[model samples]
Target: MTLLACVALISAAISFSSIAEPLTSAQQNQVRELIRDTLVNNPQILEEAVNAWEQRSTEQAGARLGKIIEQNKDALFNNAASPRIGAKNAKLTLVSFTDYNCPYCKQFDPRLEQIVKKYPDVAIVLKLLPFRGETSQSSAQYALTLWQQQPDRFLALHQRLMSKKGNHTKGSIVSALKSTGNDNLSIDKKTLDEVRSSLRLADLLGVQGTPATLIGDQMIPGAVSYDVLEQVVKAQLARTSS
Candidate 1:
């Protein structure tokens, strides 16, 4: 049979199966034979079907994530506790969930900084999420504590921490704090609780890895190219203006 005939046969079989009435044994045999012969002659059709299914699934997932973002806009954007940088009255808000010890997070910093420098009306929030190891956890707790006591020094402390070459430790955290003029800061129960809360919030946002970025209703995971980032930002701006 021709490819077009094969497709029509498959469509007919599907349409018949969807109906309430049952098919006779001969009809079932015929449909099964058609399907088997189609596949044996043209295996590419199965691959095409699988690709279509995967594409649909991805689109559905993106839609669901968009809905989630709209529902949690307050928590994602306006939280006083989240460490923010860039223009305070910016039109665009970029929220990044990162681990101190994540190499990709370190790599992503420059791209993020580049955008911040280029866009005068853009604000970026760095959400501390430590899932690397003990050192990362300690550093995150210290950063959170510093944020609670002195939110102003967060950017400096973050820069210091990100610029460090080696693994983060208690000493590294202290040194970063001191370098950022937060030498007197100490991690207490309140700050520890804040760190835990941030982790819980990350979980709620479906953040499973380091360097997850949220721009408007879109989520970009991992290290992305500047072009992709710029495209998303422009698309969002266009959408809002429209």
Candidate 2:
């Protein structure tokens, strides 16, 4: 028999042996020796199989999230209080949950902005989820405050904060705002409440970290590539046009 066929037979046999019935002593010894010899001679096959398995698992997870995004569309996309960028009446919308101190979110922020610039008809919503610490929470509160009081400058503030390194504290936040020329920054309780609401919504949506993005009926769990962002947007546009 061919080596590949032998490997497949041994794999199948071992897989079914546990569930269907226990193998006899001779059968167990034969299968074990076969697997051991095959692996010792050609160990790369195991690595190949493991890689394939991981790829399949990731694809399955993405598919599951796509369905979940569709199920929770209204809450995910229709929050009027969410900080928005780009055209308000845009046909394409991208919603992102991010923390101020999240490195991935910071890295993706510029890319997201570029996408917005490239796609004039795309609207991007920024949902603050401050799970990092007090720094993240306080920064989000200040962000929400800016969203409420000076929305025209919110994007600037967001860019500044994301660009900042080290710990995010009240002093850091205030310093960033002052650098942006907002001398009198006052973060209020209502803004804090809004941040809290965002956190609750994130929990309901099963978002456990920063940089979770939603485009159409798909949730991308991390900082996706520019190509990925473009593809998702184009696909949504095609679907809408169709």
Per lDDT, the best of the predicted structures is: 2
lDDT value, candidate 2, whole model: 0.82
Best by TM-score: 1
TM-score of each: 0.84, 0.71
lDDT of every predicted structure (CA atoms):
0.81, 0.82
Q: Which regions of candidate 1 fall more than 4 Å away from where they truly are? A: 1-8, 14-29, 40-44
Alpha-carbon runs more than 4 Å astray in model 2: 1-74
lDDT of 1 by residue, 1-242 (tens): 65566788778777877885778899889888878988898888777778878999989988888887787677777877777888899888998988889888888888888888888888888778878888887787777777777787777888788887767877887888788888887676565565676687678778889899988877789989889988888887677668
Q: Write the per-residue lDDT of candidate 2 for residues 1-242, one digit (tens) a residue.
A: 44566668977997898688799999889888987887788778778778878999979877876776676666667766678999888888888899998999988888889988998889898889888899898888888888888889989888999998765877888888898877587777787666776777677667878898877766677888889878988999788778
Sliding window of 10 residues with minimal summed lDDT for model 1: 188-197
Per-residue lDDT, model 1, residue 78, is 80
TM-score of 1: 0.84
